[model samples]
Target: MAKVLVLYYSAFGHIETLANAVAEGARGAGAEVDVKRVPEPPRPAHHAQAGQSAPVAEIGDLASYDAIIVGTGTRFGRMSGPMASFLDQGGGLWAKGALNGKVGAAFTSTGTQHGGQETTLFSIITNLLHFGMVIVGLDYGFQGQMTTSEIVGGAPYGATTIAGGDGSRQPSAIELDGARYQGRRVAEVAQKLHG
Candidate 1:
């Protein structure tokens, strides 16, 4: 079976919700999936990471996955600090090309409709590219992203959702579906590559 990891850092639970949808899609596609969250900072014990039920991920373990799907809340149109720091720690894997030929994808949540969702996805995609991983995204097949009838969040870069400015909004149903499609796409790519 293709081993897929869904790694995320969610504040306000938006990304966490989407992460589960992604994992569900991957599992449905017959991939063995593990979902993990990034470690929190040492001093701030009250942050979202502390209350998360998912186990914290080990940087070294990332290399073993055939595919990795990353999700984070956008910080100024980029990935959150914890996620950026976590990926930055994978220098050893980059040096050895351990992730080369592996599948990589990204997802994110934003506080507003125009809040840098695509940019954040690209920021994550850039890191994956540096590790020589193949990129899979929320392709056009998802269709929900193209709908203008509702306020949906998704892009060719990856899946995404809009959280209201005060973080009151949860991911819409279409957004979750987009996440699932992206996850399934990544798993399918990994299966083709590894099988």
Candidate 2:
């Protein structure tokens, strides 16, 4: 069976919820999904200096997986520091081309309609490119849109979530579909490549 890793970091549980939806999509598409959270770094003292990176979970070998799907919440229109730090830890793998030729994609949650959802997705994808992974995005032609309308999570770029301004809204139907679609697409590509 093909394996797809759904790795992410969540500060307020929104991104974590989105990650589960992404895994659901991957599972629906017939792939074994491994969902892992990036561990947070120790919080600095209240009086400590700013601009500190958070703690993250140690990732094991990616060589065993067929693909990887990274997730994060938008922070200043980019992926969160925890998620970025997690990617940084993959340098050794990147140096050796361990992720080369594998399928890859990204997803994100925004606190508002214009909270840089696409940009966060792009930021993660940019890192994936350096790892030599084949990037995949949701196609505009997917048929599961009516279940949830007016939301843009189902992008040709990747899965996404608006999450509303107050960050109280749950994942919309369209966003859920988008996540699943991307997961399934990733699995399909991986199967084809490794078949």
Candidate 3:
């Protein structure tokens, strides 16, 4: 079976919610998903590791998966710092062509409609590109966008969730569908590429 790595760094829980939806979508598409959280390092009483990036909540070996779906919260029109840092640490993998030709997708959560959800998704996608991964995006043809109960998900770029002003908005039915569709698409593409 093909494995999809659903990696994320969620702060206010909205990103985490989106990650679960993405996983569900992958499962529905007949893919095995390994959900991994980037591990955050413990805050030191004193300033330790002056040049280190922010602590990750979890981490995993990306080479183990056939595809990777990264999710994060939008921060001022960009991916969160933690996610960026994690991507930066993937240089070793890129140098060795570890993730080459793998299917890649991105998703994000934002506070408002124009809160940089698309930008965050692109930022994540850019990092994946450096690893020679093929990017996957959401298409309007999917019925989920038009039939969803709320306007919480879907983008020309990829799957996303509008988490609302207070960050408590649940993902709409359409958004969930979009996520799953994207997941299935990635799985299908990976299978073809691998075969």
lDDT of the candidates, in the order given:
0.93, 0.77, 0.77
Candidate 2's C-alpha lDDT? 0.77
After superposition, candidate 1 runs with Cα above 4 Å error: 43-50
TM-score order, best first, reads 1, 2, 3
lDDT of 3 by residue, 1-195 (tens): 678888877766666666777888778778887777665435421221232232333333898889999887788999877778777888778888999999899988888988998888889989989899999888776767555454666786788888887766877767777777887787878777774
Evaluate residue 189 in candidate 1 and report its C-alpha lDDT on the 0 to 100 scale: 96
RMSD of each: 1.4, 4.8, 5.5
Q: Which clashing pairs does model 3 show? A: 25-180, 37-58, 38-57, 38-58, 39-56, 39-57, 39-58, 40-56, 40-57
Judging by lDDT against the true structure, name the best candidate: 1
TM-score: model 2 vs. ground truth: 0.86
Model 3 TM-score (2 dp): 0.85
| Per-prediction TM-score to the true structure, in the order listed | 0.96, 0.86, 0.85
lDDT of 1 by residue, 39-141 (tens): 8765532345347788999999899999999999999989989899999999999999999999999999999999999999999999999999999999999
* Clash count list over all predictions: 0, 5, 9
